[model samples]
Target chain A: MNLTGWKERLFQRYLIWSCRREKIRRYLRDSLPSLPLPDPVDRRSVRVGALQVKLELCKSPIAFADLVHRRVKEAYEAGARLVVFPEYLNLLLFGMLPGIEELEKDYSTGIAAIAKNEQQEQTDVISLPDLFRFMTPAVQPLIFTTFSALAASYHLYIMAGSYTIADQGAIVNRAYLYDPKGELIGYQDKIHLLPVEEEWKIKRGKIFNVFESALGRLAMPVCMDATYFETFRILEERGAEIVMLPIANLEAYNYWLALRGIWPRVQESLLFGVKSALVGSIAGLTFTGRAGIFAPLELTSNRDGVLAEVDCFDNEALAIADLNLDSLHELRCSHPWRDHNPALYRRYFPQVYKR
Target chain B: MLVAALSLAGVDLSSINGYISGLINLLTAQKPVVAVLPAHSALALGLGVGRLNSSNTFQEASAYYFAEGTEWTSEFLNLHGLLAKELQIYLVTGNVIEKDEDLSYQTCYCLNPAGQVCCAQRQTHLTRFEQDLHLSRGDKLDLFRVGNFYTGLVIGNDARHPEVGRIMALQGADLLLHSGAIEGDQTCWQQAAGMWAQVQQNQLYAVEAQLSATIANTVFGGNPSIIAPCETTFGNTGYLARCNPGEPLLCAELDKETLSEIRNDNPLLKLLNFDAYTEICGSEPQ
Candidate 1:
């Protein structure tokens, strides 16, 4: 097991003991007989929450985790059972480390030097993945240590936004899921990379992952994964009812551009999506967007097929809303996939429509 | 530049003659590069008056439809022909119950600017009510070149399926034309599905032409619209033009420039999981 997984169990034990007061507060509320249980099984809904953060540059990896913990606790107090944070949450780690400002300046100079010498020499390209190798050893474990402890303490599931971590010989962006018990449930790596990411030499992930949860079957397709229909098909085949997306858009900063294909993915797959976006400027990149909760026809329908969204942009904000699993159950027949004969549609797959 | 999504309300044998004059007026009014009419705008079947519902609720609808060219189509085309040289109006004929030598289905004809049929498609998927009407299904989904845009064709119920739209997107279609007749008394089940569903999922532009007339006791939807990809509009996205049940036209410009711009900003095409997508079945697309 890795350091985070090993330390996670120990951290969880400490959290459970320290959070005894919170357990008593919950006990007091449930002790009342008048408050009936909120329906069971197919009839019930889960109140999922999302945090949109224009996260500040951190001074330390530990401090970054502390910031995330405060937001997770806020979501729990607002009555959210599950909470998701925005992408590139680990960027704060680099910001937090001492002398990072100098390292960044040196890194920029190195990049420019490499660009100028590209025609003269035949060596390796300087990528962000290479830059990550320098930071992984010192701060990677603590990032996971923080998330695992926070999940156990708050007693809420957390889809911690992705961070680049060294794997094999390359670096891949991986999102971690922490169950309420604080166990490392599973992780999904990003399958699609942006053009800038390609230049950074960030290797792409190959698999689409689905994990079982107490609430229902859940999946996480980081940002660009939702742009592809095949990603939804794989999740749907696995019977995923909820899909959470952790997205980050840099430079473009347009809310619509960041959230372009969301409705189509949820609607086509009959999945509820809880979107968490990173909003703010960072490393010459300005991320802008308000996180959204949605089903199909997201903002198009009169009911908007959802419950809540971020109130504003470029600042930290959150909203929690009940998503009816019952509504999804009832919609099985009406969804267009009902009429499709997959056996027949298979013929169209191999043919190239567009490269 | 004007694409007209027209309302054909209460269209039956008695009022067929008046439709000719109205159609002529539209064809002559300030010429359009390409104009469009809704499916089932030719005749109305009396499904509005009857409904089949169960105890606490019961519902029924008319299943009858009239074939185009009985009188309305010919007269409408004759007028459209006068401007056919300059204006190319997509005459999406009203839905019809048709029968070949060995099969029967409900179908619509997508005609070119000169009033010549470009392609014909039947409803590949049937709703519960359409199945009750004993409608046959069509097997092919095809795309057509309308003026400068590579457009794909889909009927009302087909918009609910993402694969259908994805296939068109994959085939390099710039715009999708959705022609269908949705129920007017749509209060509960009709809120979420339709043209917008296809547009968003495909992440492309679409011009929707919906049946906007009441035939007999049946109320057809008149909310024909034009929608752009949400990215280009910056979350200020949705129908650029949408008409209410009482309106006659939902007219708007097809902003291909903005569509191209959004597609460039977010190139979803390259992001596809083609390795897995094509791996589902080993055979090539026929």
Candidate 2:
């Protein structure tokens, strides 16, 4: 056999083995809980933090990881039990590679093409799948190891909001959830892929699942998933108490749209929602939002539902707030969920919203 | 488009005719097309039901069920029905104990510009006290047309559920009229905030008229405020009008054209994921 053929076969084998190992590692991590709560579970309140960053073309992947580590440390010091990062975080990793400028140049053109609803053709920039394929397996492992170690060191849960990776011959945007002891608890893939993502051949996820930790049942809905309120409804139905949203919006209008979606979900679902966004300029476009922690507006003294937030837009910010689950449980008695007239609302299902 | 939001200290049932005349005089003087009285304020005056306290007050609320109370309530409704039609103003008021047959519900009355009763909205969600009082829940929702615009009425505690407003918006309502009595003095801010959120979420206009009176030895909280989506003609300021604490009037002009423009520009209502919503939201939890 030719050396090239041998190399391709070996690479395919390596990917399969790596994926299996990763799954087992997650299972092992779950079994070996570093801080398992007692049966009664004394702690009901949890502190959540969101890290907002203005991603730029980085010098190297290692430098980008260091930047993330710095913020994670800040969030930890601020008393955050869980910290969320923004979507497409691995774009920084892409920025560090050679010929990244060429790929960056095509980003706007590709987005504009998608905006115009043009047929997918030859995109000027390297697609997400191509980028993931280009990332050396060794380098990818190093990045994951760093994040895992960071989570382990701080003993905090990290919703490392989406990084693109090749999976079973296709690429998907996956958000990793790490436990306090740095064990891979689970991960959720982006369900609603954007037009630009579709251009990059990013596969959309099929199922939504919630993760159970010491804190509570939490769901991570990457970016556009927030737009589909039904997703949150299912999450609530499945007993998710918190939804960590990691989003990236370059336009001001888009930011407002996303927040508008986030705010109401928490109220309808009766849960806590944290939005961590990518801010600042990336590839000539500006991200215009800050990270925020929101509850049912009734819980806040100001009555705006905002628990804590970074006030300034397009800035590196970390927002942290303590959530009392007991009080939230108390509020459920008054929210009308128990006595809602399901029969009166049934018409909406058949006529307006057929599934 | 002028509106009046009253913050009365109490409802004096002894001089009921004089009290209603005073309200009519104020409406005529202010020249508002719409007037919002506090929730159940009309019932208090008609039935001689004073602010509820631990001890028996002027008369028992159940007295409204008596032949005497019923006569007084009928007279009150007959009088207001003629006055509202004569004024040529669209009026929305609610939570009057409607004792009909064997069922009892707190119903809201919507009076058209012609002074004719157009719609009667009953409270759907009942608070604990309301359940104890055996108030029958509302079965359906109704929207009234005021010229080219549509309005939905939300009674006490009905505003808490978001679906109440959302369903109305989906039915092409441009404004939501809320009238409720909240005993929690601190819940005023939350109600305002909730109303504010509803406007943005539904891309519509809203006005909340809450009861402000001393009852049950506690001062009831009141925040009669109007909320609009940032997409208004005023642009980004989500409130067209707001009242001071215990203020008697809240007035504002609603640009129906601007409301439609905002809804069109964003089009969130039309762009809903109905299939997903049905599959997930409508499903009972397993």
Candidate 3:
């Protein structure tokens, strides 16, 4: 290397380190408050408390209803106000497309009984394929009818991670956040598709969404979408005090790996004002249960990291953490990224997307 | 002893000697030691020896290039520095890509012993294949100095971008370490070698350490004996070490006095301006 070249490299590195040093210092000094408890609906305060998240992978569609009923009772008895299930909780019927013709006959009768809230009266003779098809058609309407009844019966919120609604032939993954009052207060469609599904031509989501719930304005990034940091960043920018990721982490080892791990740390450091929890289920072949809660940004040896992590692979477990919203608001006041020279970044990477 | 080399722009070549000697003085005196880990390629998971694919998809491929490896690499580098005692291990963040839908590369990060990223810089230019892959272009060139020792890092394809090495020199990097994977060159082997020579000329003490043959599906096979000033590259064993230019696992001690004399004699730092170049390039239509 020549004399001139060497000096140039030194100066460039200096600028970068200078920028990072400030960020690191900011992360160390500013300690955000813990999550606040859920207050009355009329109050503007953010609620942070013990919320137990459980992911139950019902092997098939036939056993799903029974599992849901039993789990609800157990979770309620254990004092869980909100419980979540994967995209197709009715897996009992999801795998049976081959016998659609035969299944449809039984499905029509069962749908009628389920619609009328007479679940016990519904015939159990229906095949899995029939049930799977039944779960697809009028998914939203039927889901409300069933989960609302369950929510009313238990007086708890069932944040169904997602269910594919057959819009014509195209299925849209949608999550329904049901209130204890049997009202569906929030709904979010899965924005990113599985790579295979993407290859199959599923329509990419047109909306980057965050919905206001009793706990906080929650942002849900479906499955693969969480891999993209923008979704989480957008949630923070849009006043989403709490970010809930309801995903099917069907990777080979049930490992969320880097996406599940490092990203939350980055978010905590830069956007110290938000508490993010990712609840994932292993539905694939090696269903090593990796379900967990990512609490607000906290100090970990000078770097910001996840306050808590739930189990990655297991049958069923609830990871709980306290997230105080008041502290988040306080941290926002002193955020460095929020005060960065926007003009400089704009001038640098002109094509960068903004939410 | 792993030495990686990269190309530099003519503008940065003027002050290269002083920068290198100053760094040597800092190392000799303050003794800030660092472990510079190269970023693994995305191919590490898709079709390489390293089992970085903890997850199933190609998306995990990005992690192979720069994720927990960044964590482990940083941690390991810190450990190396500790082993050297007074040597403070500074991690060189090779070029790192951002987590984007487009899956483009971002800034490279190097960690200090405290696990803090002490220095980081992005590759401002994209190579041919990188452009084909649609990698995002970076803006500023960066070089970091800790105590006195300074090093510029280039990861994977960034090794091929001359501006990165040059920019590092202008910013005051003493020695340039380039971490990359050189898949076997097809028929255009000579052209690639010529490119390497250009980079070496541009960045005075340029060192290019490649992952072993098994790891990278290496294409370049020039005798390391005639290549590096050091007698070894980091992490590779099976080389003839006593040769003059050295071999892989090649380690070289910089001649601080000689380097300093060169910089004093050719003090062209002010004459070659970056502002003028950027002004012209910035206005050019892409």
Candidate 4:
């Protein structure tokens, strides 16, 4: 708290910062910008085709990271300026817990803590080794490094929808939006969680957030929040041009209704204004083919007419579309639906959100 | 004849109690009252008020919100001002002023249709944010009349509380002017209901204008403006404007005659049942 103590601490912190900086420099000589990757055809002026966003339904927790890495590379090849993937992509890489013998050798200490905590709760405590019989740690950093490198290498934007990761000791569900330079520009922690999935050790987000970047303003409302039109309305009010949603859309009537039915109704309600691109996913069941783009309701951008929808029920191909930022504004100006006012009709209804 | 303009959109709390003397005076007033719909904007576009800080320039402050936020009342007033240059344009606001509550006293300006402020609303709602910070909510619901129409301004969220709308209506308000924001599809259902109530129950007009989006939800079209009738079951009809990022302006016309026909048929406004109903209700069903 004193000046001298603060000075000493500041100096020590600076030293640590420089050391970390130097270590990264040693591995990655010079800033990644100096590297000569071919220019992207200078297509910034030309309006691209329909915006196609793909969600790589990763099978294993460890596979989640690699899947994003691979799909991002594919998206770049497909010429997608923005690409999104689902929640908990990295955790899937660890695969399920490994067998008991391997768990005993590899995770005995961690498992003991789990057993002790379980016993305290008055529940049956399975040994870590026994639990490992089904799942194994996939080394999350391996996946992180791969996506980070790919983003840096390809000069693309990526929305790795909420993922469960350890920071210090807590497991948090975090969303990261990487810029064209592969720099992590925006971070939104999931504010809401699925009531059914409690084991993921996820924490709720305290704020509804938005992010600004070179492409435009973007925000992600994890999974459940996407269903709340208020979330999108607030985002639109806040100047969010595009909303990237990375959902683990499961196969249920409600989920299906959201992806197909309700989303279109929302698109119509715009009266003639606000056009936001919907890029999202449904994890686990790849069969329903849940990932795709929802726009064209307001024809500012080229009607790529749903450029691509992937078969998520299985290991499938990616959805592709060329997104044009200018077209969004242009359409808003031209469409009447965007400008209609309902108060003129003399109708007033009340809306309430229940916890 | 002098005309007074009023709009009550999405706020139902302003409905007058039938037994109250305030309700009787409001129903008997004679004026060519027209209620206009609230204006619309995008979600990211903060209302103009969000930008007015102690030191920021008006231009710099305005940039903090999307251009659409300031366009609603300013645009509509400017358009109407042009049509009736010699006629007075009385406007109403729906919520507390978004920014510069201090300036709200000076906010009302009378403009000549060219979109200049001919008149502005005094702050009607309590100091919303500054009460905890540096300001307090305004206690007075200020009133002004142009032509035969008596007008008052209440913030948009205030419309949900009927008293704000009813107070103005009771003080010989032929119409109410509302300006604020509402986000999403449910707005359609709510706005429709308000239009019906204002015309049938109040026997008056309420013009509702609103901003399209809020800071929380960024997916919406334009403000759905409605002109509610004081009679009939036609419901409210008008235009739904797109949000700034999405589309263009939507316009519609409201037939004023519907007010007369509904008033003639609906006997609920004339019948005396409050005494019996109150007595039974007050007895507590022993």
User: Highest lDDT: which candidate?
Assistant: 2
Stretches of candidate 2 exceeding 4 Å from the true structure: A1-42, A97-114, A117-146, A163-174, A181-183, A189-208, A223-233, A249-264, A297-306, A333-339, B1-14, B47-73, B184-188, B233-235, B279-286
Which digits, one per residue and each the tens of the lDDT, describe model 2 over residues B1-286?
5665655544344476666776677677777677666785665555344332222432244333332345555665666777788777767764566777887887778777777778888887676656666777775777887666688888877776566676777777888888866665666445643566567767888777777765424456776777787656254556677677666666777778888788777666654545345444345445
For candidate 1 chain A, which ten residues in a row score worst on lDDT?
A31-40
Interface RMSD for model 4 amounts to 19.1
Taking the tens digit of each residue's C-alpha lDDT, what string does model 2 give over A171-226?
Answer: 88888898877788888888766655666777888767799988888899888777
Q: Give the winner by DockQ: 1 or 3.
A: 1
Per-model CA lDDT versus the true structure: 0.63, 0.68, 0.42, 0.40
Give candidate 3's whole-model lDDT: 0.42
**B53-168 per-residue lDDT for model 3 (tens digits):** 44454334444554434444434344333433434445443344454454555566666646566555655554444554455665654556544446565655545333344445
Per-candidate alpha-carbon RMSD to the true structure: 7.9, 6.0, 24.2, 19.8
Best by DockQ: 2
DockQ of 3: 0.03
User: What CAPRI class is candidate 3?
Assistant: incorrect
Rank ordering of all candidates by DockQ, starting from the highest? 2, 1, 3, 4
- On a 0 to 100 scale, what is the lDDT of residue A171 in model 4? 50
Relative to the true structure, candidate 1 reaches a TM of: 0.79
**What tens digits encode model 1's per-residue C-alpha lDDT throughout B146-227?**
7778877777677766667777787778877777666654522232345565565566777777776655555666466777
Point out where model 1 deviates above 4 Å. A1-43, A99-127, A251-259, A296-302, A333-338, A353-355, B9-14, B43-62, B66-88, B184-204, B216-218, B230-245, B252-265, B278-286
Worst 10 residues of 4 chain A by lDDT: A346-355
- State the RMSD for candidate 3: 24.2
> DockQ, in order, for the candidates?
0.21, 0.22, 0.03, 0.02
Per-residue lDDT tens digits of candidate 3, residues A240-290?
655555554444432223233223323432332221222333222222334
